[model samples]
Target chain A: MNRDALSAGLVLLLMAVQVTFVNRLPLPGDAAPDLVLLAVVGYALARGARAGAVMGFTAGLFGDLLPPAAHEMGQYALVLCLVGFVAGRWAESRPEAGLAVALGCAALGPVVAVVVGVVFGGAEAGVVALTGGLLPVMLYNVLAAPPMVWAATRVVRGRDRSRVRSRERGARRAGRLAGGRP
Target chain B: MKDTRQARATVGLLLASALVLMTVDHRSGENSPLGPLRGAGTAVFGAVEQAGASVARPVVRFFEAVAAAPEAQRRIEELRGENERLRYALAAQALDHRRSAELHRLLGTAGLGGYEVVPAQVIARRNVPGFEEAVELDVGSADGVRPEMTVLNGDGLVGRVVQVGPSTSTAALISAPASSVGARLEGSGEIGVVRGAGENGRLLHFRLLDSATPITRGQRIVSFGSQRGVPYVAGVPIGVVERVEATPGELTRIAYARPYADLTALNVVGVVVRPPARNPRDAVLPPAGQNGAGR
Candidate 1:
């Protein structure tokens, strides 16, 4: 339960970093990688679909309602909720799901965002927007997906590992206390 | 693990809630019921973003050095010192020199345009997966920045203020897919509309209202100014025409031009509180030959 909160907090902080640091990078094509989306994909891959969906919704609301956000209040919320679900489910089934899922979701995020933007927000889905804008962000996200996803999952999974270790140590201590034998 | 009904239900619920929120916000227009929530969010995240902006500055400088290496190489040569000790300091000094030069040119542009302005640094910028480009300025309502005020940089028109917080404001660049600016040909005074081509502000789409205006390559363009100049002031240099499209049967002639301001990498900007009494005209365009106006 506490692990969920830690993962969500990390993703929220990543959103802050996204708006502040990532977006300002002097990357070619003037498009920065979608660190927030990758963080969500990162969290979802470790946590299951249910937790992923909840965390995705929470982070999506944060992204949508954040200041400097000009789009309709739930555009990202809807897109990311679905994205979280897809990534979680994909990871759940394929035991070896790592780089492939991470990269797929990274690429999928921009396409879905463009679709959601065009349908609800009336955003440009034109050829220029695709070739110039979507391409770079997609490329950047794809390149960064593996390491970012690994980092995010490590934040969630690292705690679980430590908690299990502590529990095992507690069991050994209890056994020794009971009889001073093993 | 198999697909569980519980996970499916949770996803459904979140998706529904999101759609409901989008619908409510969309139907309400400018004065949405979520206004207060948005304000609170701005209060919180805006602060975080501000802190992040300071951290991003040095990193940006490093990248700018790499991106503009060819140009910086020439600058390094011009900045070379007689001794090796000072050579190590050249990079930092060059970066600082560039920043100060940007500020100097920003004020020079404002002075030439006769605009009363409040100077501000770009604190943060948000792009819509590359669709729209918006930047957060450190100045806000406290600095007399209201929605619709013209914004510019050292080069030329940057954008216009859209939303103002207590200590920060958001401005959408002239290159946003949704943005459109009224423009006039510098020499012929032919009227046209400048629309963002959505190519990351690398270029803009301009359509001359009069098909017979005889606009050729290398012609300059300036803002036509709105009534009272709410969003844009008159005679602010916009860009120079780079390519004129071949439109035989169209009512309006179309052309493409590069924006004057480097909308892709913004740093220092100014919000105009008051516009010039009279149009500054071509005087605002860099005094020939200097701006590479291609005579």
Candidate 2:
């Protein structure tokens, strides 16, 4: 109904999808597509910089709970926050541009993920392992993004239109009452 | 605007929280204040996971049904191959039984003891990528799965239980980089420390007790037992000698071994609860084997 409620519901849906189906989906190796990153990027692009950053942090926190290779906890949060900020800035400037933003966000998602994973995870992990593990998942997210964004846009716009219609009806009723009294 | 300031404040707070969590996670060894919180978080996550699984069950069932058609054909082919392998294995086992009976008769005359077997099931596997060589089992403190307990599968030594929890315990496989077992060649009686090499290979660094005792490839390596106590029972098959070499001036010989146990596909295991007594006359070497070899 409201923006906050919509965002909350979206976050929960994204987290649920990530932990359940997406995590279980067998990729090339043990890696899985990061649905939470996609959701964070999409949300940030639709909202502003601040909203994106906050959502990114929250999504990252949730991602930490998802099967981690190492014990390092908050690495995901830092990386996702950066991703959100970057995506949010892009969205703010080019509000109507969707594809370019989606591509850039998707591309950055796994790079940030790998970088954070390598630095905080352990000394044993190498660049080859990180690339081999994360790259395919990134590609999947990029390919899946356009349709996802389109659907999300449709939902948001439909809600906005309904709100506008109700506001217009209320205004008309108030005007009629005022004119009738005069 | 007020909203902008509130947004900034929220981001700041989130960052601070993340920092705190990271510090706590890094520093808080085995026992931490946040341990309970983590357990609680995992439980909550597990609940969400179940709900998500419920929602996706229909799709999963459909996929399974679709996949089963091709799988049925594959299963038929697989069964045929399995039948052939089983026949070969049965023949091999018959030969093994004959040799074992001969060895048992010899050992009985020599007044040596026999071995007992304990069975267990692998319950939990470590999901960590690099640490794929380890697993946690349902058998633990209650089931006599104490720390340093040697674990064996159907074939040979898998690893030892490093850490024991109340209901679960973590076992590092023989393939792990940190694992080393004191093993001696079955035929030659050449003693060597079987250290895990990269991948599935174990490097046997032989302590040259007698220069005359030559090592050979394909020799079965068994545990020599420790001086303090035989944590691993003697005569448990460790690995087979794959390669052997000697240098002109070197004090000892070096060899490589392929462990008998399959590091992967581990479903059931056996933990040696009571290890056999060690002979005090045996010399002690460094604790070479700790974890798997792959780093």
Candidate 3:
């Protein structure tokens, strides 16, 4: 399969992981890591803003559309889209900005999400929720970032190679069609 | 420079679309356009989850047992102490068994009544992002499961089926903020309403209908069977009163009931397919029937 399909499949697989195991694990503080968010941040950081934003939108839409998604639809989508953009633009200078960048994105993503959820969806928001739910979740996301970032970077690298190969193949086809010497 | 412009446009477009979808979803009611998509996701994912749970159950149990060892040890010790006290009680209980058995035989006709139950396994669980609780079950409309059916574990009432797919159903647990059930004080037969207090708290809040009714802690609570028994079936255990809080300046008092069924640890449960038989004998507290008085 092509890079886009593979990446999408993998992201969906990560979502399944979030639902099946991550949510169920007896983690302290009832904070489950947002696996999909971590994946989005890593993929976006590796691929640049446009790819990241698109991936974020798609992944967030699926997150909203999927079952067990209790909140109002598109809330996560909006949160992640903005998060993807923020991560992409901030880390633009160096797409593969490593662990610190990934961790920062992990921390910021949920904060942005919680803010947007409260502001737009009128969700419950208070100091307790922030300290109790958001912070711990961010920490959990940070714990999950290393492997997630590594896998995301690999997906991005594979896509880069595929794009390059396809471009070269098109160029060769055009050259042959133009009588070889033009 | 050019990449920046493209990135800006992409983010703006996607973010705008997301906002639009969110607004539409919020405004739409049961007919929300995303309902089918959500159901499709649930049906597919529920199957995969159930399969995965079966495969992972052993692994999960190993870890659970490892984590639970200390607690288990403490509980064993506690049970040992309780056992010794219960030994004397058991001897006294044996003397009453004949009378109790006769009572049970009579109550058996009146107790549990005509409710036909269907057993189901919990396939998946998702706390609706901290505000609500829901679970996907292996049985659905196909298994005679329907919306509003009362669900229970062996211990007590769990919740009610809120949505049904072809092969999977979603149950809105009693823990959900919007959920409320008619409950009865087992000893006095006094009725009250048990309402969920939201995710911030674990216990359910109940208020008595009459302020004059005296309530005490540790009183057993059971379902005050509803008409036609859609949301809850009568005679199903709900909880035990943990504490009674008198509302300041108000005549009524509130009691916190700890549910008998461990909602967090639900694995297998039963759904009542039919309501219990309504009879004249049901009106009699400690229902009197042909065999003897009910327990």
Candidate 4:
């Protein structure tokens, strides 16, 4: 019930939805909105640099596995890590961090994704493919981010406080157990 | 503080790994180690996906059932009529079977020819939008499939196998931009090279053997088979001529043909094993008539 476990479960849930359901939505050329990126960005904004970086890597790894054509493994992980780091840093600077972080990350997410895709996927990448396939996808993800963030906020705000308390109790119990062992 | 540095180092390592993967992929043209890792990732993701689908299936089924109610009723009525028609067709087929048996008996044929048909289910689709003209089929080298073999559905030609792997083969549909087939007009006997024009149809560029003989619209075109080295079989129905035009006093006529098979609705297809011999020399025209043509 700890934050890390909850985040991990959410990440898997989002990735599964992304691959099986969201991708099947009658989007242009089978393009799906990047739900994993949104989750990473949201977590980064809520937490800080270290958390963002870790979550981003996990999400990117999941994204890399979603497509058969995504033969390049760590490319997504790298790009998403950078995305989370930047967003996390930006979130620290802003007063109304949640919405601003979500919007900003949404805007920048697609550019990073396309650049990484082209660099790894090869030279056969066409303008039409980028514009039609990747661009619309980015736009869709950006549009989808706010609602998902709001929903996550509701779930996290309700469950996270209790989860954090339970984790603290467990940590204290572990500390006592370790102290008594020797 | 050290943890922050470790996190940065991890990110750096990931980036470096990505770059190395890209380099390896570019140089080798092979699926990198990343691909298998990604596949494993997908498998995990796929499980969650399946779980989500299982949760949502009843809702989807309800909606589908509601939507299909009227259509289902109409379909039942239509099926009743179709059953009557099919019964008549079946009777006719029985009569034709008797005649066919009599002819075969006169020819001293005892049994039906031995032919094996294997059914393959499409597992993955990899149609690169606007660039490549092929999709990968799950059946591959494991299924006795090889490159350059002709693929056909119940209607007509689908495409040819281009890349084969242990478990998968990429079949380039005829509608792809890179696809080229040699075809000859069924009526006029004009030979031409049919190339996919990156559209729903193909562009037939005819080689004018004699400038005097002009091709008209609505002419039937069939595969001209292989030339000296080009790979394709003869007598495969390519398409019918939709439009033809003389290129403003040019020697040859340019025509567009719609492929006989519906390229998009492809599900099951048969791969023709033997190559058909319908070379340019095999065209009914004499060598004198074939001279000066460049197809």
Candidate 5:
């Protein structure tokens, strides 16, 4: 499969796992980790801004369509897409995609989610709820990011090597030249 | 520079799409075109959830049991000493059985009514960034679970079913900020409304209708039973009064209650599918064939 298809398939599977099993897992309180967001942020950081944004939108759309979704349809979609775009853009500009950038994006996820919620008529999206859920979910994403990013990068690179031989060689040469420059 | 332009374009397009989707969904409400899509997703995911539950539960239990073994052993030792003291008090407390019986008669089954329940296991929880407290049940419309049905656990009331899909349903916990229920204080027979405090797994706030009515600490509270029992049923325990305090300028006193049902650790629960047994009209009307007896 191509990178696009592989990413899409992986994201779909992550969302399914999120709603089916991950959400039911026991946590410190009643809080459940946002596994979908974790996957989105990881993929975005490994890929670039455009890929991240697209992945975020697709994953968020799947999340919105999942059962027991009480919020507005596109609220999560908007928040996650922006998060992915921002994270990807940051990674693209930097020499390397740092863990701090991924963590920062995860932290921003809750603020964006709350803003979308309040704007979409969920007036009760106050400071308390934001703070209460943000820290834990952010921590969860950070903890899950390393493995997810590694897996996503491997899949994308594997697919790229098998399909676009010439583009793969060019990108590899560019990567080496950039590495050698500094 | 090219990368920057591409990033900006992608972000702008996706954001615009998201906003449009949200606008359409908000305006359409339940009639949103995505309803069918959501239903289909629920059906497929619900089955996946059932399969996952069967495999995951045993693994979770095994880990929890292993982790809790040491603590359980320590607790047992403490309980053994406490048990000896309790046994001594048990003899003395035997004389209070008559008073306990009287309280039981007044309270009626300690908040359990004569209604059967449908059992359901929690499949997923949709905290949704903690904006709402809701859980999805494995059973739904097919299983006779309907919106407004009362949900409870072994200890007390949990919440009510809010929305039902074909094979999965969502329940709003009583801890949600938007939820409120009529409550009755045990022993005092005083009525009040229990309001959600918005803190998940935290104490619920209750205010009596008549503030002057004396309510004390440790009093049990139960559902007052709504008309037709749509939201809550009578005789379902709510919680115990953790504390009572006077609001200096307000007439109504506020009490914080610790719910009996462990909302955070919920697994299996029972939904009250049938309504309460009595008819409201019976109170105002005479028995069958007795209307003309006085005349």
Candidate 6:
């Protein structure tokens, strides 16, 4: 319960920073890293599938409700939820495979978001967005995933880091998966 | 890890709810039932975003300055030469009428297009990639920012106020796929609609009302404004024509133009609460080829 609360608070902060700070940066590309997605992937790797899914949902809901919302209320929530769940499965089974999963999930997120926008919103606008925004954002997220993923796991699953570092295979608890490159 | 079925159920449930919520919001259309909810969220999050923005501004500015170092270096060299020549000219003649005129234009209180504007800093930005681009401003309804008030930077039209909270409000960018503005050709006065060219936000599609009006690559476009200037104010620079599309048999000719304001890098902007008494026409526009890289 305490872990869940900590992760939730962290995600909320990530969402706030993403909207206010990250998006405002004069980055090279038109898009910024989806910090919420990165946090979700990281938290999932640390906390397992159920907690990951719930975390993703909460984070996505925050993204939906936060100000300057251009998309519909539930659009991002659905995408993040799925990313969290699959990332959790990787955590549960192959805990050492953290960085790869984070990269894969982060890359997959924008594509899913584009699909969701087309299905739930307008097809024409979705096509236009995918063509223009998808590549740069995908690349940005993937590049950012490694460091952000490591940081999230460290922040959310602090106690477990020592255990993972000591290479205690199979001694890991639920909601505390080893993250990053083995 | 062992509770696989339960975890799957939770995922399924959350995904389902999100889908339902999206569908309800989408179906509600213009007058969304979630309007109040959105407003409430804005009120709550606006304060948080403002606080966060204040804390983050210095950090962001540092990175921006670093990222722009090369350009800034080049600019410094150019300015040094210009400064040397300016000092020589100033000594030659203490009369500085041309310089004063430039300073007056830069420092004037009368905003672009003569609108009474409330200056606001962007506290948060929500960019939905190719579909939507919106930003939350620090000043809001408390600052007399009503919904539909025109938001512009010195460069040109940014967007318009959409949702106003007590201390903050959101404005969609002119580059948003959903945004379309009424625009007029600089000299011809032939009106048309300029729609956001989605995705990269590098260009806008202007469809001339009359296909035979002959809009060339170097033509300029300005806001036609709206009734009482509710959404857009008159004569604000929109963009300069970049390329005219060949629509051989179409009634309206199409051209793509680059927006004056750098939509990708927005900071301080003004929201026009009161539009000019008379249309400024081409006066608000930056002299052709100065900011207008039309051709």
Prediction RMSDs, each to the true structure: 7.6, 9.9, 7.8, 9.6, 8.4, 6.1
lDDT of 3 at B44: 74
| Prediction 4 global C-alpha lDDT | 0.58
DockQ of 3: 0.27
lDDT of 4 by residue, B93-153 (tens): 9989989988989987343321123444333333332333444455666688766776766
Tens-place lDDT per residue, model 6, B1-295, is 3499999999999999998888888789668988888889989999999999999999999998999888998899999999999999978666677677788888884354355789999988877565467899999888998988999888888899888899999998888766789999999989999877765567787889998888899888988876677798776788899988888989999888999888888899999888666554545443455323322
How many Å off is the CA of A64 in candidate 4? 2.8
Error of 4 at A59 (Å): 2.5
Q: What is the C-alpha interface RMSD of model 4?
A: 6.5
lDDT against true structure, model 6 = 0.81
**Candidate 6 chain A, run of 10 with poorest lDDT:** A161-170
DockQ of every predicted complex: 0.50, 0.19, 0.27, 0.19, 0.44, 0.52
TM, chain A, every candidate: 0.85, 0.73, 0.82, 0.76, 0.79, 0.83
User: What TM-score against the true fold does each predicted structure earn?
Assistant: 0.79, 0.55, 0.70, 0.55, 0.75, 0.79
Model 4's CAPRI class is incorrect
- Which model scores highest in lDDT? 6
Docking quality tier of model 2: incorrect
Tell me the spans in candidate 1 whose CA falls farther than 4 Å from its real position. Answer: A160-182, B1-9, B66-73, B76-113, B209-215, B246-253, B276-295
Candidate with the greatest DockQ versus the true structure: 6
- Superposed by TM-score, candidate 2 places the C-alpha of residue B139 at a distance from the truth, in angstroms, of 10
Q: Candidate 3 residues B1-295, lDDT tens each? A: 8989988988888988888887777789578897777778767766676676676567657766887888998999999999999999999999998898888887676455555789998766664333445666788778999878999887788899866777777787775544678888877888888765433224666778878888998888877765677777666777788978866667677887777777766778889887656642345332323211111
Report fnat, model 2. Answer: 0.21
How high is the lDDT of residue B212 in model 2?
Answer: 62
Which candidate model has the greater DockQ, 2 or 5?
5
Question: Which 10-residue window of candidate 3 chain B scores lowest in summed lDDT?
Answer: B286-295
lDDT per residue as tens, model 3, A113-175: 657755774444444445545566777788888898778876666546433113464566667
Candidate rank order under lDDT: 6, 1, 5, 3, 2, 4
What lDDT is obtained when candidate 5 is compared to the true structure?
A: 0.72
- Tell me which residue pairs clash in candidate 3: none
How does chain B score by TM in each prediction? Answer: 0.75, 0.55, 0.70, 0.61, 0.70, 0.77
